[model samples]
Target: MTPDEISTYEETLGVLGDIDHRVVERVLREAGWSPCGAGDWAVALRAPDGRAAARISPFDLVAPYTVALYREAAHTRQVPRLFAHRRLVGGGDLQIMEWLEPVDADEAAGFHRALAAREPEVAELADVVRRVHERGRRDQPWFAPKLDDNPDNIMRNADGRLVAADLFGADGPRLYAAVVDDPHLVVTTIPEPERRFMTDIPLTNTGPWPPEVRAAMHESLTTADTTHQA
Candidate 1:
């Protein structure tokens, strides 16, 4: 990314507009963490000593939906336990989540490839993915899991186990707007090369993506074009 764009991303990452500083401090103190890094919409904080950390984001609609959708994932330890903290009064819904240690792309790909062998480890991870999708709601705006999520979002921690990260994606007009607004800044700023292994990722085992996901993608881009025209 250009220096200007990086600056913009840093500025916008986890930017709390008009949010009270007290809330940020509370989350940091209570979570026993300090700011370490960030993503498009969330701030990642590291623990004082260990590899553990907390990923905190301002109250957002996606947080609640993610927590609900990953019920089985949380149960099966496919994902870090999502904590809904109302401790910040009037600060919307602050999400303080456990941050799992991330294994490099090659390591994650190794495990994913093992799935082709029907390996138990990969099977368990696949099962967690299955559960996540099973709980997904088609009627909901964010039903297109294939488009929103990817293998790069999966992490191999210290234990060599697979964990899902960046689990919240609400597909709708808002998501469309974000992509339309800036394809690089919001969508592809970071290179996700490991995604090639996931051509057959979706459990559906279909050759291509679901019809609905393709339709949603096309609609989002088209809507953006139409909006620009007007």
Candidate 2:
């Protein structure tokens, strides 16, 4: 990215004013967005042409370190694409990302069943988490903050594979402890009971796995390191 682009991005985020509806609109408009909906510090918007979805936030600056870590994760594809990160002109941080489509009830149910079955899907998720951790370790060597690792952060794409999202955290590593540590996990963000079942085993952990899962996790970390190095 050019210095000018970076400067403009930062300026736009800095203009958010006070993290309210008015500020959200101003920031979105400055960033070329059309308002859709909003939550507390976060606001949803569509690209000018309506070809993509985006979200703006003032919360990113609340924990700048964690936000940097998330940007690193995005670079490694350990998380979703990060379209933009900047300080609004009024005085807040903003992040724009590719809006992901919602996972359907049937698909959500299948994901739940697959996770419960402890089949290959859970293993795959474990691998993804491992990659995320590895990326965090290398990019932010002194700070290896744990991800939320909740169902809401995990989205399924057109091919029916899970992708992780949401990059903010309350603290270093235990943001969403329940989902990460639970042996029987279900992502409750989506309404469908069947699709809600994510993985039977919590994919985020320190170690001591069943050999295979552990191995995959190790590989993910190693690959992440090597890829970044290259």
Candidate 3:
């Protein structure tokens, strides 16, 4: 990425570190990536050219997890094609990806209907999801079972192919603890059901956010939340 683009990322470095979150948002807007949506973890943006979308995060692991998914996962046809990834200095990542078109309420509902009917396209989606989940359990521990079982997380490519968006999630406390050895690290609250479930499970199956393997995603989600607010 260009220096200007890098400026947008590096400045808004998220949790577990000190950085200016305001600058990250300002620069991203200035760079012409219009904000599309915001979640607990990151902000979604559409590129100026209209051909690509971006997952902007102040967390360090977003890019690595995404890149790993695209590269290591056996099935990815249903997922958006990653274009580029920029790892920031303060544990954040910027990902450029294929811009999937919006699915209107009707379209989304129709997709669900088709999914229920086990139409060819939706059948393919199921297969893809199963394979990805299987791989996530066997190979990628950083991955959590986050693919929502609904149409909201579904989109379509330019060619009208079904695309699964937001394929993974980050475990904030686990990730932060993994990266930083802060004995005083506050146990904010009990892990949410999904996280607790993962923690409770033993050797296999559950998505264990192993510190050694996922330490690269050390940035705090609290920081991302602040950045998003900024």
lDDT digits (tens) for residues 1-230 of candidate 2: 34564465456555543353346656567868777765433556876755445555432323344355446444334344555665443324456555565665565555545543546745554444455555555543223355443455456543444555553343323312333342122122211222111122223343224666545543443454455446
What lDDT is obtained when candidate 2 is compared to the true structure?
0.46
Clash totals, every prediction = 1, 17, 1
Winner by TM-score: 3
Off by more than 4 A, model 3: 1-27, 60-63, 71-77, 104-142, 171-230
TM-score, every prediction: 0.49, 0.43, 0.51
Give per-residue lDDT, candidate 2, residue 101. 56
How would the candidate models be sorted by lDDT, starting from the highest? 3, 1, 2
TM value for model 1: 0.49
Q: Per-residue lDDT of 75-158 in model 1, one digit per residue for the tens? A: 656565554333122322344444566677776566556543547755664565545545554434434454244456667555
Worst 10 residues of 1 by lDDT: 190-199
Task: Give the residue spans of candidate 1 off by over 4 A.
Answer: 1-22, 25-32, 49-51, 68-71, 74-77, 81-93, 97-99, 111-119, 147-152, 158-160, 172-230
Model 3 TM: 0.51
Worst 10-residue lDDT window, candidate 2: 190-199
Candidate that scores best on lDDT = 3
True lDDT of residue 80, candidate 1: 58
Q: In model 2, where do residues sit more than 4 Å from their true spots?
A: 1-24, 30-32, 61-71, 74-78, 89-91, 105-150, 156-161, 171-230
Worst 10 residues of 3 by lDDT: 193-202
